[model samples]
Target: MNENNGITLSIQKKKINDDDDDDDLTGCFKRLKKRKNRKVKKKEEEEDEEEESRRDIDNLV
Candidate 1:
């Protein structure tokens, strides 16, 4: 009975450690997603600015 309790406790500890690892992975993925979104948004803004500049030049012509 004592040995069984010890085994159960160890298993529970291992599960806790695994959960922590999952949380860390989730955080890493969220950060990566945010970075990708920022890059895409920046690219879109740059394209918009270029389009606006072209329109201005066309008007001048």
Candidate 2:
């Protein structure tokens, strides 16, 4: 009975560690996704400005 209890306790501790690791991984991914979104937005805005400039040049011509 004592051995069984010890094994169960170890399993619980392992599960706790696994959970913590999962949480950290999720947080890291969230940060990466947020940064990627910001980069995409900035690129889109730059493209828009480039298009506007091209249109203005065409009008001038």
Number of the top candidate by TM-score? 1
* Candidate 1 lDDT score at position 49: 100
lDDT of each: 1.00, 1.00
Query: For model 1, how does the per-residue alpha-carbon lDDT over 1-61 read when each residue is reduced to its tens digit?
Result: 9999999999999999999999999999999999999999999999999999999999999
lDDT of 2: 1.00
lDDT of 2 by residue, 1-61 (tens): 9999999999999999999999999999999999999999999999999999999999999
lDDT of residue 23 for candidate 1? 100
**Model 2: how far is 24 from its true place, Å?**
0.8
**Candidate 1 Cα errors over 4 Å, as ranges:** none
The whole-model C-alpha lDDT of candidate 1 against the native structure comes to 1.00
Alpha-carbon deviation at 7 in model 1, angstroms: 1.7
